[model samples]
Target: MVKHTKKAVLLTLLTVNMIVVSACSTANTSNQSSAAPTNDAKATAGATGEKVTLTYGGWKLDTITEVIKAFQASHPNIEVKAENTPYKQYFTKLETSAQGGTMPDVLLMNGPNFIKYADNGMLKDITGNIKADQLDLNNFPASLVSLYSLNGKNYGIPKDYDTIGLWYNKKLFDEKGVAYPDASWDWNKLVEAAKKLTDTSKGIYGFAAPMMNQEDYYNTILQAGGNVISDDHKKSGYDQPEAIEGLKFLTDLIQVHKVSPTLAQMTETAPADMFTSGKLAMYFDGSWAAFTINQNQDMKNNADVAVLPKGKKQGVVIHGLGNVISANTKHPKEAWEFVKFLASKEAAEIAAKQGGAIPAYKGSETAWLSAFPQYHAKAFIDMTAYASPYPVSKNTSVWNTYETDILKNAWTGEKSVADAAKELGAKMNQALAAEK
Candidate 1:
């Protein structure tokens, strides 16, 4: 899940108070913006004692700490030393270490960041170690595990998944005297809802756009029967008339519909906060926001989740976390043990209990649903019926680097949706070609 801790708490307990809990995967975030971590923080301390410390690196220090403690308690031989870095720089840091051959033993990997490490051969292929019978393969959802595999090699274990949904503010809709969205929602209904719900007098917006990949634009693109990338993961499809049409629907909400906040405004103000504060009627956010929104006092009883508005097709992006080991590691065998334990049903179960996130294991969703039953948190499971994989990219950075800035112009009135998408298609093809 999204990782944030109010403060650090150290438990000096003598023994593990095993609570039959599940292990949850944590999300790594960036704090240094574009800069790398300080030299001291990245310094490797080799073999500090008789105890074998398997250096682990992640952005989510809290989640990693918990998992490492629990694992160390059981396996006294291995001590997992976790280093937390911001998400943006983690890969950059890893790349630097990889060149110097000092990469951590265990690491966290994500899809958008995958192509770089996997393509560079910096990641260890654990497909054989994670075979169905040996690891808790049955605990994982097929869709999640498949995200980490390339050319028959598995780089990581499935951690958790997050998917997009329609988060609406009942307070805003109720005040506007408009009905909230449901299964029958269509583009027309969304437009009508936005128009009715928007009240400029109250300093409230109808919606907000953050120029995101999965939950924001891509999800809308798929709902309109358009693919961001072609099925084979080759060629860019943004130039397609269908894709442009799909995009216009969201951008139009601000440029034409005038019911949503513009790109400039959203850049200054976070959209989720605006929604939780009852400034927006609806937000296209992931199930991960269930806790973030519900925790807000203003939105606790006011917010609810629902299926996304449908276009010609029904779609939602299914994104998951994976456990990746480094190619250059001092403890390959011990790292494999950690990977196997991480891939177990028991680990996923502990995570669920700790509000870790929606477990990659199929049936483990019930605990995540239990984590926030009041917000109808089962929306993750329900949305899965219509979920689509995040459009894959072999050279992901080629597209990701240019995506936000290119799409932002369309999101504002600066570029027409069709025109901008056509230009993006050409640039995307160039990006795809550059990799070869």
Candidate 2:
């Protein structure tokens, strides 16, 4: 899920504080314009056995520590230093590093921020490298490949992908005598089950309706046959009736159905915390959350996953992270070699076995599903049949900020769904216009 408020603020800071290199700029953007590394550059890099140290930046470095160790073992000529930062402060720190011309040689790029960096000539156009190496783009999901691409040029290689699913507690369902959610379940069934399962007296809510985007409202919006942005990526869809209907679905759970905790209540205790603590009977989360959810001993035997209940139709949001090389890197060839390994089947297999996230590599999901036998983990992959890419644009954070601020009104009942969504559409349109 996109943490709209914090990330949006950092993105704005990045655009303001860092030097914005034009896509066509020749001064500091030579890396961006270069089609491929010169043969001499490659000869002096890892291929020639020259020792090189490259900084790799990302949040949650612990998750890929094993992968990094494996890369170092295979490529003894290159040493990768891990620069770990919390996700909350990741972009802020990246911006600071970019300003100092100390950006990591290789870094993680999420869908929302990928275009921004590419547009500013901060990321190397890896199209030439990919073609030179004959790395099959077909090895990953098309959505992810496109996510990190701009104008027929690829800038990043997918590391992994995540899709949303409905996570529920079997113990709670059994106690309430509610049947487990399944593929056939729809909006009405979810509401009925939630009503039966809710027990305010016991401080347990039947469902979690937090003010979240990717994990909550975004899926609902898509399920209602609505969209967050237009197909052309130039307009907002929030003002559409279908979009309003989707937002209303979640708000009604809190306001009309009273089966969910209010936004304020959820603020006091995060819905994920509630789920792990057995206070929330049902919640929606991403496939990346599998490890964290299973970490709770109490939930190990009590929880399982299912496809999200359909609204007007079945839908879910799909997103992934990619490994991008910095345009200012001193070791372009070495960085590409490391990035190649990161996107290779070996790395994907390690990721699957280690269980940080679902590997985006085509044929590696079986290992991931086998990694966790406690829950029906396949439900995460199953939803990909109807999953839509998480909405993005060059300035996704600007409109995301508008979404976070404006949608709070509807979630709080301060404004009607129609009013909040309509207002948000107008604000988002202004931001979209500025992108031009």
Candidate 3:
């Protein structure tokens, strides 16, 4: 999960400004010639005792001040300068830097945009770096490591991971005389509870059916035995019956059941805001929002999380950011050094204790769970048993445009879900075909 502050903005950017990066080869090793550093590359680029400065670009740099200070204390020869851009503008800034040949030495990269940057010859191939240093790839979740890998070559070190969970307000449930959700809950139970909890007179909704993907519909699609992209990555699954059924479930909540906030209502105020304000009984969001949501005085004592309700089967989407080196960086060795430390247990521990996103480093999650003792945060980790990778393609940005444009009608109740899904599938298919 990119920071929650950037979710709506990033979603818009994906449809608007995300363009095909370059006409470069799509091979996993395409960047090796110019971007990958040789095995015998020196540890430092300058004189034996000189220092190297690395520019680290990411959203919310202030969250990791302690980690950066600790990194420099250990690697005294490397000075890290953080380039903190607001989450909404971070990717746009990165694109400008890549186009102008001034990408930061080290930067944070997300799963959806990873293939675009890797295929366009903008990111360093770090497979050799991992091999030469013998960094244990096992430290991170295999799914995340694979997400950052292209064809068998690793390009990034996964920094952290996040999964979606059901966030319910205990006070609201108690007030409505509704039982709290749990692992045993299924789609039928969720609907029954939602109907009971909804109160139109109080402007209170039972659930939130936003037009978002990762945090909302994608999980349901998987649970309904559907895929967003096909196994071979060449076709769209939106036109399939399973996918349409999954989508219709949410649309019906707004149009027929009248238990959820409409797209327009959620647009005026985010679902997360409604949840914290005690105007919603149940909401779905990523683990990345835990800390920020807990900051609400009322919610801090009244809310907790549970596994998402099962549909045909249980499923959730997993996504995370990785740290990658810029192909154009003059200091590959120093950049790799900085990246390696960022993936280390020490740094992961710092992030976990701060209640940041879930650390990808194995065994480090305990600290993160301890940071939020009031809630059942471990439900997020438990969901990993049935988690699916966030969907992507070589030209994901192209198809992303199709999803937003075609699906908005279904979300607004202006078009039937079946019709909207079918249109989206056809357009997405054409976009995927263009990548070949």
Lowest-sum lDDT 10-residue window in model 2? 19-28
- Superposition error at 178 for model 3 (Å): 2.2
Query: Which scores greater on lDDT, model 2 or model 3?
Result: 2
TM-score of 1: 0.83
Q: Which stretches of candidate 2 lie over 4 Å from their true place?
A: 1-47
Write one digit per residue (lDDT tens) for candidate 3, span 336-399: 8889999899999998776567888988899889878999999988887778777888768777
Arrange candidates by TM-score, descending.
2, 3, 1
Candidate lDDT scores, in order, read: 0.70, 0.83, 0.81
The digit string of per-residue lDDT tens for model 1 on 1-436 reads 1222210110111011111101111111122112222221232332233566887777765654556677888878788888888765665665455544566778777766565456545567776666633665656656666667776677888878888888898878888788978878987898888888888898787777567777788888888988888755668989997788788888888878888888887888878878877788887888778878768887888888888888987877788778888665545667777877777677777777777768777776776787676676676677766676666665575576677668878877787888889989999988777655
* Candidate 2 lDDT (Cα, 0 to 1): 0.83
TM-score of each: 0.83, 0.89, 0.89
Model 3 lowest lDDT segment of ten: 21-30
**Sliding window of 10 residues with minimal summed lDDT for model 1:** 6-15
